[model samples]
Target: MVDAAQKEQLIFVTQKSLRMNRKKHFSESRCLQLFAEILTVDSGLKPAFLFDYCLSNAEQIQEYVQELQQTGLLSENLHILSMQENVLIINLNRIIQHLERALQENGVQVIDVSVHRENPQLAETWVTKQVRAQVDIIWKHLKSQVIQTGESKPGLVTASEIFSSEWNLCTMFGFLLGFPASYWFDFNTSFENCLSMTPLRAFSVSAFCPRITKNLKHRMYSFSVPDILYLDLQSAIKTWQRELQSDFQTQTMFSHLCVSTESVCLSAVML
Candidate 1:
């Protein structure tokens, strides 16, 4: 009983709605692909990562998290430390335990020149002292912040609280994220690092993560270290790669992830 013009208008509207739905679906799926890469945290390859919540709507974020949980991509050990601003800082609740295990198992030598540079006599014991001192400092800082914010427990601290602390935010995150050679500097004197004009290499690991959607492939994590330290950190880097590969083989979420790494020469002052 419908006229030709009326029928044409209805069909056009239906097609437009379908197109809009597809676009939304694609956008959410893309976000999932990138976000799900943080499953590396749960796998113990890394301790934490930052997720950008601004990339998707709240509903989409909820659904993405739900899907990850349902599929075990986001495990019980992993938790969001701060849901502030655009970036959500995700980390393990038992961070100290994780860091201790990573340090012991990977044969990573923790060295902090900042600790022993002032007192050269302490060089021999500095490495051991530095590890415990740094961990204690970070733990105490986090505990105080969590208590003040009432976020959760000592494990669930906020970014804003971390920023308010005396320690450098980037340095703290670098350690928490399990980078072998995190740059250390005196924040009181100046936040500037000595990497100016120095040759640097950007290291990135990427994978075709299909937990959310088959079409998504992108870099999971990236960081830069001084070219000079490449040799010193080579062992740690290899251990990290091996652990990632082990995860790819054993973890259900990382099946077919196809993780790979690339290094490129780059120069930057304020990394």
Candidate 2:
């Protein structure tokens, strides 16, 4: 019963709604308003009619919107609109387009750094490269000591040292690697100290990183390490074995600790 020309028009309208979804900011109310506009124009129907149509197909529309929201591609406003409407008939074209344009203008990098951690070798290479680059730069500018070690894992490296000057190179490197802003713990706060920081313990840092969440949702590679260190190699192996018994194999949290083993050294790269 649908004419080709009318179908094309519907497609165009849908595309427009998607475009808008991309361009706008995080306002739930605004999304509802835009959705209202798209339905009117795309379907040549009144809001009441469109509302009814949506009501009839509520479940499908809700699933679609939820998928978009999980990706961080959906505006929070759209979500609010869905709640108010009691049905999910917002114009997909307008919402998506808006979101796309806004993201472009802001130069927001929505990359999944977690994917880099997928292949143990690749992950190690990336971590080593990042650490080395950071260490090199700090060494050139400051009088600091760096100690680096390679884990048995192919590409993983861990480096730590005290800089002579009060330069926060470790924090900078962590930030550059797209680690959570909270990963930069204070020098005074040891891993043990963080255990008692109840609020910090309550949530995973990856929860705050949108890119990481998106990657995880999409089945891309991610990384996680426990908050506490195993006392020895046997303990570490046992922990890994026990963890693998779970439905989800990956650890959800990671803690980077700088232990004081010895005194100052110049520069080192682990991997």
Candidate topping TM-score:
1
Number of colliding residue pairs in each model: 0, 38
> What does each candidate score in C-alpha RMSD?
10.1, 23.5
lDDT of 1: 0.49
Prediction 2 TM-score vs. true: 0.16
List, residue by residue over 1-271, the lDDT tens digit for candidate 2: 2245543443344343343334533243333333333222222111111223223234444444444343333232221122223332332223233223323333111111231222111123444344444434533322121111111232221122223333233333332222222122223433111222111111121111121222221111122222222122234333322432231223222112111122222222111
Best by lDDT: 1
Question: Estimated TM-score per prediction?
Answer: 0.60, 0.16
Worst 10 residues of 1 by lDDT: 115-124
Query: Model 2: which ten-residue window has the lowest total lDDT?
Result: 197-206
**What C-alpha lDDT, on a 0 to 100 scale, does residue 101 get in candidate 2?**
33
